[model samples]
Target: MPAPPSAAASTTNSTATLDDDEDELNDLRVAIAQLISLPQAGSEVKEKGRAALHGTVEDMRAFLDTGYRLAQAQDDRVALAQLHSKPDTSPELKTAVRAILRTSDPEEMRWFLEVGQYEVDQ
Candidate 1:
């Protein structure tokens, strides 16, 4: 029987996969942006560009959804660890765990990556 993956191996794989996803997402965004920057073109070309943009947007949504799931899992793991370490999981403890989970904003991540930015409440 095959052995389960080691923690180090799992982390490495996750990071590599996330990195590849980021690269693909960035490439798609760049392609769509380039299409937008071009001078006015024929209806056929414009239509194709719009289609490509829509598809890229869908791809991005997929990537973000996957990342969000992973983030939730990570949060759950941390919360579990906290529970294991302590006898009481109080309301304050639950609130702290929730705060940790909620601290990672997808919009903030995009802004940090310089993908795009809009005004965000501080």
Candidate 2:
């Protein structure tokens, strides 16, 4: 039988980095903290925020489920950047991406933008 991979090779082949998972986990924590900190966020905002937080958690699970090595998932952010840079893109798409890039908090805002469920006021 062929020899097993060397320790160095095996370590290098790990598809997910601890730093990445930690950062995503930290994001979830921050999102949760916001709800606690801002008691006046209102029922509608709270509902949206909770859903967004749930989505972020699910996204992490989905990423882990894919062996964390799928090129497409890794490439999505890059693609988003490329599309945002292209002036020829449709107005609606550009508006949506701009909304996503606006803030790292309130993940629901980004989801709404991505799904075209909410329009960003100029």
Candidate 3:
């Protein structure tokens, strides 16, 4: 059989793993900060990002992987609802918001919130 790894080799591997984990954690922190700073982030995204900032590494990773998108989608839905409910909102904008709400694609909804709405308004 092949020889087992030496203690030095084991320590080096462990140190590398720690370094990787630390790097990932730092990246997550930066992502959360950026998300929180966005004007369109809505309440759910901001709340989730704030929670992730204080949570464990796994929590941070989860936030970046799936939580952020899900939270943003929820916030986007709320925004659409608010737009639809507004008294002075143009028919074109309301129809566009309704169309976005019918679709299941989060990116499409996000796009509508970011760029498509302005196009509709203009």
lDDT, candidates in the order shown = 0.50, 0.52, 0.91
Residues 1-122 of candidate 1 have per-residue lDDT tens digits of: 99999999999999999999888777876655554355423233344445555675675454344533344344444434454356665655555445544656534332322322112111
- Please give the RMSD of candidate 2 to the true structure: 15.1
Q: What is the TM-score of each candidate against the true structure?
A: 0.36, 0.32, 0.80
> What's the candidate order when arranged by decreasing lDDT?
3, 2, 1
- Considering every candidate listed, which one attains the maximal lDDT? 3
Higher TM-score: candidate 1 or 2?
Answer: 1
Best-to-worst order by TM-score is 3, 1, 2
- Between 2 and 3, whose TM-score is larger? 3
Clashing pairs in 3: none
Query: What's the C-alpha lDDT at position 44 in model 1?
Result: 37
Candidate 1, which segments miss by more than 4 Å at Cα?
Answer: 1-5, 56-122
Q: Which runs in model 3 stand beyond 4 Å of their true positions? A: 1-17
The TM-score measured for candidate 1 stands at: 0.36
Better of 1 and 2 by lDDT: 2
Of the two candidates 1 and 3, the one with more favorable TM-score, higher being better, is 3
Give a tens-digit lDDT track for model 3, residues 1-119. 99999999999999999999888778889988998888888899989999999999889889888999999999999988998999999999999899889995899998888889999
